[model samples]
Target: MRTIHAPRLLLLLGTSLLVRGGQTLRSGDHERGDVPGWVMITLMSATLVAVILFMAEEALTTMFKAAMDKVNNP
Candidate 1:
């Protein structure tokens, strides 16, 4: 089974909710800002994940393997 980080998931969920709950930008606001809060958060999150994986590929891979081994062998 794959493990999910509950904290990160909840953080993202809460952030999206906050973004949606706030005042919506007008159509003209797109001229000033390229994207909305939620969109920026999503893009930044994906980029952050990619950068983290690139920087810690070996450690993350090892941890994943260890977890998988534990599950499969247990």
Candidate 2:
């Protein structure tokens, strides 16, 4: 739904843009290697947060399913 994937998609797009921009900047500058400083940090931070959120969402779904099973069985 809009309330769920919209925010996540926007966040992902923003992070992707930053990552791409950083790569371009670093590549343009021969002194730097791979991604730039700020881009590397930003990508890592976003990736970490996204992974945590994904895990939490999975946990929440599992918990909800368990609760439903208990209720249905009882």
Candidate 3:
């Protein structure tokens, strides 16, 4: 029969307790932790899109006009 020494048994129990405590602390919900970072990223992406649209407005308009003309003429 394998017998656990008192010190070994105490160490095993403590390790198991720590593992269980860690698991309990981590609630398994999908954690969205960095709200501000995501918000900043989203804002930056939107700003880039706005700037690109502003800069390319004339070109985009011309392209659309050409595409429509081709479609209508076809």
C-alpha lDDT values of all predictions: 0.67, 0.72, 0.65
Tens digits of per-residue lDDT, candidate 2, 1-74, equal 34556357657777787777767786666655545566667666777777777779878899999999999998
Error of 3 at 7 (Å): 69
Pairs in steric clash, model 1: none
lDDT tens digits, residue span 1-74, model 1: 98656456657766775575453453334444534565668656766776787689899999999999999999
TM-scores, one per candidate: 0.41, 0.40, 0.57
Full-model lDDT, candidate 2: 0.72
Model 3 scores a C-alpha lDDT of 0.65
Can you tell me which runs of candidate 1 are displaced by over 4 Å?
1-42
How much is 52 displaced in model 3, in angstroms? 0.2
| lDDT by residue for model 3 (1-74), tens | 99765446555655665565456557654464554465456556655666777689899999999999999999
Q: After superposition, how far is residue 51 of candidate 3 from its true place, in Å?
A: 0.1
Instruction: Estimate the TM-score for candidate 3.
Output: 0.57
**What's the CA error at residue 16 for candidate 2, in Å?**
5.7
